[model samples]
Structures are given as C-alpha cells and as structure tokens.
Target: MTTEITARDKLLLYVVGMFAFIFFFVQFMLIPALSASDQAAADLAVAQQAQIAMQDTIALSGTNAAAKTESWAALQQANASYYGLLSSSDLDTLVSNLELGHNLAPLSLEISSINTQSLTGYAASDKAEDTAAPGEIDSSDPTLATADTNAVLMELAPPLTRVYASADYFKACTVTFRCTGSDSDFYTMLDDLAGQYPSVQLRSVQIDHAAYTDASGTTTGTATFTVQLSVILCDKESVAS
Candidate 1:
C-alpha cells in the first residue's frame, strides 16, 4: 500500500530530529569536556602545592647545614687553644729558673720529696694527715720521698689537696721541700720561685720561727726559720704521650 505525506508532517519530523541532536551534544560532549577541564585544574593545583612544600624542605636543610658547620668550627677553635696551653714548655722551664734564682740565698733550700699518689688512695684514708713530724720519717726508703712531699704540700695548699687529670696527656705531680733560713732569706726564696717559675704554684707554705740568743748574747738576729713548700710539676711530654 502507498502512504500519502504532507508538508506540515515533514516539517514536524525535522524539528523533532534537531531537538534530539541538541540534547545529545549538551549531555555527552559539552558536559564531559567541562568535567575533565575541572579535574585537570585540580591536579595542576596539587602539583604546585607539592613543589612549594619541596622548596621549603630544601631551604630548611640548607639552614641546618650552615648552623652545624659554624658550631663545628667553634668547637675546633676551642680545642686548639686548649691543646696549645697543654703542649707549652713554659712550665718545665720555670722550675729550673726558680732553683737558679734562689740558689744564691745563704739559707739551705732542698726538695726533700716528690709524690705521685693516687687521688683515690688519699681519699680512702679516714684522717688525712699531710705533714710529717719535724725529725720523723714515714719510711727510710727514698722511694717514699715523693709521698712525703705530697703530704707536706697537702698541708700547705689545701685548695689543691687532690688533683686529677682530664686526659692521659696531662700529668700532675706534687713536690715537697724544706727551707732553713732567716725571715729575709725565706721571703727572698719565695719571691724568686714565684717570679721565675710560672708553673710552680705554691700549694702550701709553713714557716716555723723560734727566737734564740746568739753567742754574743745579742737577741737582734733571727735564730732559725724552717719552711715547708709544696710544688706542682706540669710537663708537656708527660701529657702528650
């Protein structure tokens, strides 16, 4: 059978087709394109944020490194100064100079003892007695001389009664000596020792002066003065080794 077509009907069919095409274009193409553009913008923003965070981390690391370097340099300088003082030979030379300078005195000056006792041992004793009797010897052996000296020194210089070294490079020892002279002679000896020896620190000093009449019955002259002195020895080789 053959069907009849009208112009109105044909125009109506064309309008319906145009409306369907417009709906599909907006839903499938335009809407998807807009969504994809929004997603891309979000990803770009995240990447920029990550880049900024990375830059901040790098800057902090640089600052920390510089601070560490400066601290290390300061520590090195301090170490150098400490080592220089420890290695100096001035202290050793001072001892000899003091001896020479005081040798001219008419009074007798003698180092009776030198002691290298352990700090621990000295502390262990219940009663710390540093001075020996005037004529009594703790031991007849010469090896005990150092201990005796240290004892006398402990009595003289209470501040340095006990000493310890921070490292093996530093050596500490004590010296004990007896001096018999007039008041003037004793003063001269002390002055010369201090002036000549920078390292010879006087730890202890004891002066025993007694009045006695001379053969002429004159009480004008000083009869006798007995002194005990404590000396410290610091040598570079002893410390460096």
Candidate 2:
C-alpha cells in the first residue's frame, strides 16, 4: 500500500537537496581555486628570490672590476715614482751634486764596482739577445726588447718574477764616499740624497770624531758612507747587448 504525499514532507525534501548542492559547490570549486592561488603565490616568491640573487652576483662582479682598475692605477703611480737606469752623464751629474751640492766637503767619492743581479729571470736577457739565433726574436720587437724600468730592488715571488721577467733586468753598484762635515750637515745630505734619488740605498756609515788635526791644531770630524744602488736595464738597450 502506498502512502499519500504531504506538503510538509515535500518542503523538507526540497531543503535537504539545496544544502547538498551548496556543500558540493564549496568543496569542488571554491576550495580548489583557493589552493591554486596559494601555489601561484609560492612560485612567485621563489622567482623573486632567484632574481635578487642574480642582481647581487652582478653587483659583486662590477665591484671586483672596479677594484682591479684601482689596483692597476696605483701600481702605475708607484712605478712612475722611480728613476730608471742612469747614463754616464747622469752619473757624473749625480757625483758632482754629491760633492758640491751640499754645505759639506767631499774629500773622496768613488764607485767601487758594479755587479749584475737578477730582479727576475730576465736578468740574463741581454746575454741571450747578444747570442740570439738568426731566426729568433730580434731587437726590433718591442715584446722582448722594451723595458718597464724601475729602481726599487727586492727579491720577488714566483708570480711577480714572471711578470717582471718579461721585460727588464737589474744591475747593482757599490758606492763608497768619505766626507768632512758636521753631524747636522751629514744628516741633511743623506736626506737630500734620499729625496732626489730613490734608488740609492745606504749600506753602512762610519763616523770618526777626531779624524784630522790641522796645522792650526783644530780637530775635524769625518764620515764614510757606503751605499748600493740598482738600475733596471732592457735587453736591447743595454750597452753589452
């Protein structure tokens, strides 16, 4: 036997159907959209981080390039402050100045000896150029012949040795001199020498308080100074070559 439909029952069935439709809409459409939006936001954050890292790397590279340029400029300025190899006339002028340029009296001045020394492996380049084969590099080639000369002399590390050895070599000389002067005058002369010629190195100094007694019976003081100096010379420009 079938039961007859009632208005209240029909109204209840309609209400339940509407509630089920709303639940399915939230679960299938709204929730998935929200989840996809969150995933997109996470991907954008990762992309932004990658972009920031690339910008930082580019900035670091630029800073390094600028630093290298500054270092090169400083090196060039330091090289410019040096006096390269001296000629015969230059030596004569130097000696004259030492003897007469100051208030002190120079009794003797002499260059005892000059010896060849290597600032780098290129020290023997002059000899090599002299005995070079016909097919080998000639003196006209600037690559092997030119010198970026300087007077500062010191032992070099392997990397610097290769750098300097490409062009120049060093030669050193022993300079001995005796002079009669007051203590103040002696020190002044030394200061003058250092300012004018950065290459001159003071090796030793000896002072005698009562070195001489003249006919007037007045005592005089004397000082002896020994110095070593170096000059950078090119293979093709050297006299021996």
Candidate 3:
C-alpha cells in the first residue's frame, strides 16, 4: 500500500519544525551569551572605578622642595640600613665567630647554650633611639629599639612615606646566648660588639651570681650572663631571586 502526503500538509510540517528548532536554540545558546555579556559589563564597570580611585590619589600628591629633601634623606638612610644586614647564608659563621672570639676574653668566658627566634614573628613596634634606659632591659625589646635605621623608615617613619614603604619589609634575626663571664668582661664585650656591629643590638642581659667566702675571708662570685642579640638579615627571597 502507498500513501502520498499533500504539498499543503508538507508546508505546515516544515513551519512547525522550524519554530521548534528556533525555540531550542534560544533556550540553550542565546540566554547564556546574554548572561555572559552582562557579567563582562559589570566587571568593566568595577575596573573603571578602581582606576579612577588611583588617579585621584596621584592628583592629591603635591611637590615640595623641603619635604622632598627630608623624604629622600630618610630613604637613603633606610637603604643603607637594609644593605648592612648579615647575609642569611653566613649566620652559622657569625655564631661560630662569637664563640671563638669569646675565648680571647681577659676573664673566663664560655657559651653554655644558644637560642634563636625570627624577628619576623614580632610585630614591628615604632620603638627606637640609641639610648637604653636604666636597667630597662626588662621593659622593651632592645634589639628592635636600638640603632635600627631601616625599621624607622619602614615601621615608624612619617605618614608621608609609610604608604610607599612597609613596616615588615626588612628581615631580621634574634638570638639569645647563655654564657659565663665576669661582670667587667661581659659589659666590655657588649660595648665592643655594639661598636663593631652597629647593626647588632643587645636585647637583654641576665646574670646569676654565686658568692663564696674564700679562706682569706674575702668574697668572690661567678656570674653567669644570658645575652640576647639581634641583627638585620638580608631578605632571603630577594637574594634567591
């Protein structure tokens, strides 16, 4: 048996198929394209807002000769201080040298133990000035507060330059020494070490003294001193790069 479809029916079928295809295309492809276009427009708007904010910041900055000089001087001092740090690679050498040099002391000197903590752990407090307060050893971190030129530029410098610099940009080291030495020899060592390495700061010194009465009825004592030392260190990442 054979059945033939009329041209009118064929035309109707063709029209319906075309409409269904158009609906599916709109649902699957066109909607997603429209949504992506909207997201792109929103992202562009946000970027433009950020750009405008940065331009405003630049516009507000004014140039002054005196301010410029002061800022430049501070910058120079900071850079010098940064370069003065001990290279991380030589940390062992420094410890060994400290121990070896101690043997040359006029009095008995020996290192009993050593302990260290990274300065990166401590928050940078805007504390500094070359002066150590009267027995203020217990009051503050002397290592962080003394002869730290770069730390000032980074952490405590005037607000004018702080935005351009970071308080924690520079890396540093902290170490503690448990040692035995006579009072005179210990103080002498501290003073000399400070002079030799302006970059090194003495954080604290604790001494335990044991007094004994000799047969001559004279008293003698042995002082065990604990000294803490800290110094700037070359930025590990910067060197590796």
Task: Give the best candidate by TM-score.
Answer: 2
The reply for model 2, stretches above 4 Å from the true place, is 1-61, 112-172, 194-197, 211-241
- Model 2 C-alpha lDDT per residue in residues 10-112, reported as the tens digit of each score: 9999999999998999999999999999999999999999999999989899897777567555655555555445565565567657756676676666664
Best-performing candidate as measured by lDDT: 2
TM-score of each: 0.33, 0.44, 0.38
Each model's lDDT:
0.49, 0.57, 0.56
Off by over 4 Å in 1: 1-100, 103-169, 223-241
Candidate 3, lDDT over the whole model = 0.56
Model 3, 51-126: lDDT tens digits are 9998886676554445656776665564454433454446545654664566422223233222222232333322
Q: What is the C-alpha RMSD of each candidate to the true structure, in Å?
A: 16.8, 14.9, 13.2
lDDT of 3 at 137: 30
Worst 10 residues of 2 by lDDT: 232-241
Candidate 1: residue 214 Cα off by (Å): 3.5
